[model samples]
Target: MKSSPSARSWIAAGVRHELLTRALPALRHDMAAPVSVIRMALLMLKRQVAAPTVDAAACEERVALIDNQVGELVLAIRSLRDWELATTDDGISRSALVGQCVMLMRSAFDLHGVSLEVDAALDPQEDEHRWPAGAALRYLFLGAMGYLHDGADEAGAIRIEADGANAVRLQAVKRDPGTSPSVLDAHRAPRALAIDAVALQSLADDLGYAVTLDGDSVRLVLATGN
Candidate 1:
């Protein structure tokens, strides 16, 4: 059967539209690093320009804004560095990796007067299969809560449980019970949340896990059986 001219035109247009939509995103991502450099240069130019306006408070506010932007840029650079260090070409136990992260946050725990206890005790000689990389976010966020809510005295507690298999959940408790979800989740942006959400999402994306938060409880569920 001969296709109508309008039908043929629609098919051609759809194909071209799909190709451009996909290609444009790829092209933009490839150019992002250079574009970021150009943006930094422009910000520097603004900082160097002669000050025409004379309000001291306004100048201080601009300085604060620039400092915050620089801080975010620095954090992105550090996250890239962490991504490099987190991988091991050879197999490494997931438990050991999580232990290392706990040790790294040990000082923070002490500073906040929080106690950390791990329920998993494996024999040193036992050989368990290594889990996927990037699951350390659960540990990182659990430890961070210890540091963030340390001043809550007897009110703050962090509990982690393994629901058999690959499911894990971390629960943060406050005795006062007045803490709102906003206080716990804190970060309002879709791309930005509390350190816990940020780290959890990163690990979820890498490891194909489902990470979610409900009220004050945060959970990470690994999808694969093996």
Candidate 2:
């Protein structure tokens, strides 16, 4: 009558796969516009620079804007690559993963007037531990950022810290006392994030991690062994 632990685990993995099928596409869609804009801007900038009569000031402004947009595009692409690696069960360094996530969300945080910080506490010796790459971790990071972005007060800050030796703990805290305590919910997510909170939570559960919301922070504990 009751399902065994192994059976439940199997079911959970299946659910994660299904969620991924939906979530990945949504993520790609969210990223498409930015990528397109960057491509177009680059082409236009190239033509402008090639023109002999280009205005120096106008060229400088366009160059700056292109540089900024390119930076954002690079972050998004890195995050997408990481997610792909994770889905394929590839291995990536913990520091690299966290760094990518932070970079990927940095622009969004800046747009919302939220400060994002990352603290890497692991020793150099611990860098040998390779994290199991997958959408679960990516979802966890993005979901936390989404929650913080929505709930944080103006000029609020988010702190992302990696702690622990054998088992790594990744935490994101919305560091404003005025921030509203909010759990990420699919129904409440903005139209921009097509993936819902339930799918993100499901992926976390399937990956043997729990996303806990305490006050204004979302914490995910990851076991190195997987």
Candidate 3:
């Protein structure tokens, strides 16, 4: 089935943004640090080679440093490659995925003094359908949590509940009355919220999911089949 032009464009933009903002930066930093260290070690070795009398211990230490750096670089590359592979649409456990998302946001919730309650009953082994790839799932969670955290007041609570067989619901209540309207609100489009909302909705759509914002709650519905 062919997708609409706008959908295609949205998917493209979402992928580009994810690559640039998350994956590439992580890869660059992980790879660059070791490369820089290896380069420095090599230059030092070169200098030692030119010296009239090379200190054996110093040369051995330099060689060991270079070896360690190379090992670190290899591990970093492998880890990045594995992460990329995991983002494919191959099925993953729904329960596990949701748990991971919750774990990722736990720290932020603690820092904000907001409590989180998760009532997920979906069985990971029995649920054969995976909502989306790992990275996209993370992106969706990040976007949703970002929206919720911004709206939540100190001591407020966010509840993540699994609604029925195929839907995940995120509800935030007890918000500060004085707090400004949620970014998810159509009328007031704050810059950060606007960008995140668009990205989240677009990515969800591309992944065959539907996101609905009603009051202080957001529900993501997973498609029946791939």
Candidate 3: residue 141 Cα off by (Å): 3.1
Cα error, candidate 1, residue 202 (Å): 6.1
**Best of the two (2, 3) by TM-score:** 3
Runs in model 2 deviating more than 4 A are 1-81, 85-87, 120-126, 152-155, 166-200, 224-226
Q: Write the per-residue lDDT of candidate 1 for residues 104-156, one digit (tens) a residue.
A: 44444434444444556422226755655442333333323432343233434
What are the per-residue Cα lDDT tens digits for candidate 3 across 3-57? 7978776674655364335335455677899999999999999999899998889
Candidate 2: worst-modelled 10 consecutive residues by lDDT? 180-189
What is the lDDT, from 0 to 100, of the residue 88 in candidate 2? 70
Ranking by TM-score, best first? Answer: 3, 2, 1
Candidate 2 vs candidate 3, lDDT winner: 3
**Model-by-model lDDT, in order?**
0.45, 0.57, 0.63
Lowest summed-lDDT stretch of 10 residues in model 1?
187-196
Output the number of the lDDT-best candidate: 3
Task: In model 2, state the lDDT of residue 175.
Answer: 46
TM-score per prediction, in order, is: 0.40, 0.50, 0.52
Task: Give the C-alpha miss distance for residue 139 in model 3, angstroms.
Answer: 2.5
lDDT of 2 by residue, 1-226 (tens): 9868687667556544543443465456556867777677778777888898886787677778778877776776775555442357665565655665665666555544566776646323453767665455665556556655555444256776665543334334444565543521322434443324554455566566767666556666655223
